[model samples]
Target: MKRSERLVDFTNYLLNHPRKLTTLSFFSERYKAAKSSISEDLVIIKRIFDETEVGTVETFAGVSGGVVFTPAISDKNSQEIASEIAALMGESNRILPGGYIYLSDILGSPKNLDKIGKIIAHEYVGKQIDAIMTIATKGIPIAQAVSSILDVPFVIVRRDPKVTEGATLNVNYMSGSSSKVENMTLSKRSLAPGQRVLIVDDFMKGGGTLNGMKSLVHEFDCLLAGVAVFAEGPFKGERLISDYKSILKIDSIDVEKRSIDVTLGNIYTEEK
Candidate 1:
């Protein structure tokens, strides 16, 4: 593989698997390259990430040397934990077809969304979170719930710029499945500089929307307190987010049986 391509792939692998590091020898064997070459690649990638204020690359030196990506906030420590996620995911639900699932009921129920939202807000209760963001079609209600509990503002990420909006910014992200770039937009004045934000969504399929939201937050010169998703979909191959929380992880949706399988996500245990 070309050096440039290998570097890009290496970074993607780490970003997709934060806190999971593979040794240099592993990469050396996989790429059939010298250890020195791999080391150079890691340095280049780490520098690029730090300069952009995107990610952090830490290298453990010694007999079991490896690299790990540690996000400022990890899902495992979110107000909600993974074991709790499994319990919620245990319930079955209706699946229409083509792997598409309808979750309108969950989003609309204030009580249900409230419990989940509060769990997420609890983590940022004193973090000075300025607002919550969610991408429309499905995430609006959940975002609103979290915003209410946090007593903060809420911003919606639109699929396209509406005529009524005065000014907006657009960002392109790799769709979770297709890997094709899609556009999501938000009003320019929604988030202010030096503001802290908590990103919330109804579902996290591929984290494409999360990445887009992160980019949008960056454009507004805001800081991200964290991200929380009601449910996480399968396919955890190349995720763009690191610090996040998910209540449930759907294993499978049995459309014919009207049942669904789910598991717990990262839950916060320590007192924040």
Candidate 2:
């Protein structure tokens, strides 16, 4: 095949398989090209990713050489998005007793969820994200919306064990916000080893759930493309994981005042 055609298909594969490494033999088999030619094309593709707002392309070297991409969204975009979501959170109807906010409206708004999903998908546009993942019930919409943008499978992690269509994997977790032990499960066949995964959720409180999801990703022996959330609560103080993005942070919610203070935090960070 022509060098141009080879590179085109090569980049496409990279975008479709984020953290996976493609050895010289794999490329050689796919494109009928020499290892050296594939390597050169990969270098060019990696450089291109570095210049875009979309994502990262990390090239692994040596015997198991392949390239992996990770999304790195800009801080400006993240802040702007947070402001939008925070404003929406201002709906008086969203208020419930004890300062808890109801997100049924946001969860049910496919159009709005589409926008949020697209914004995040744009950040990982060209990276291969095997499946978009989130916890069951609450996170299904976000995961579905994002999966729509990326055109990948949407995997749901269930809060309780139930019969699912495919294989299953269960996990035990401690929910940070509620300070309660919880369980989450995913279809065993949903994710593959070395696949790239993008984690998304509607909101984050103390990051306990995200931490549990992180553990599942690790267990799969795959790489985390990144984590993204719409709103982050004030309780997320010094969690064990890093490299996450949230549009807004809730500093305080005055139950009596019926007010929620919103600010922005690290949606963008230095990547080594």
Candidate 3:
């Protein structure tokens, strides 16, 4: 194949299989090219990836060394994506009763989900993450998108236990929004002891649900790597959790006026 064709194929493979190591010999053999030539092609690919701020192509040294692609989005791009989402959410028609904003359309969009995934996944790129965990239903897409980019498995936490799950672990947590106690469960086989987990959700208010997931992680003898969410709304009482990240912040909602104030969340403002 021509050099251009080889470069296109090489880039596509690395992107589709993020975090998977590929030896130079594998590419060399696949492309029917010399080792030196393959190495040179990697350099070019790495340069383009870095210049575009899409991700990083890491090259390992030694006999067993290989290349791994880590997907990332620049702060500027992250800000742009967040701002766009905030605008979409700021519309008066999106405001629902009880201080809630309509999010089904935004969360359901493939374009929005892909960009949100990249922004959140970029935060935990180099961290040791064994599995992505999220509550069942809305948070599933966000978790799945991040899982795909990180090339890691994602597990779901359900409100009720299923017999198909076999042995399960359960945790009781206070619901932030309703100020009521709630129960959540996880399959015992979903996570192993000592595995690091990242918790993600579609929306957060009072952090009751996220706190419940944190407890489940502890119950399973796993470490909590971090927490990320698509959007966060104002919590009247003290929040259950403090340390977390969000793509957009729902600053204020005027039910009477039919308006919502939205802005970029700490994920964009925090120092890298």
Backbone clashes counted, model 2: 4
User: What are the models' TM-scores?
Assistant: 0.64, 0.67, 0.97
Reference-based lDDT, residue 53, model 3:
85
Error of 3 at 240 (Å): 0.5
User: Could you give candidate 1's per-residue lDDT for residues 1-272 as a string of tens digits?
Assistant: 66898897887777666446679898888888898898899899888777754456888888888987633323433333445444544545546677666676656767676666656665564466788888887888878877765557799999899987769999888887778999998988888889987888878878888988998888888998888888887775877776677767677877777777776655433233
Q: For residues 1-272, could you state the per-residue lDDT of candidate 2 as single tens digits?
A: 99899988877887776445567688878998888887788778877876764567776778767666654445565456656776888766676897788888876887778667766776665666888889877878888878865667888887776775466777777877777888888878878899889998877877889888988888878789889887777674565345677655677777787787766535533342
The local distance difference test score of each candidate is 0.74, 0.74, 0.92
Give lDDT: candidate 2, residue 177. Answer: 75
Worst 10-residue lDDT window, candidate 1 = 71-80
Error in Å for residue 271 of model 2: 10
Q: Which candidate leads in TM-score?
A: 3
**TM-score, model 1 to reference:** 0.64
Q: After superposition, which runs of candidate 2 have C-alpha atoms over 4 Å from their true positions?
A: 1-82, 268-272
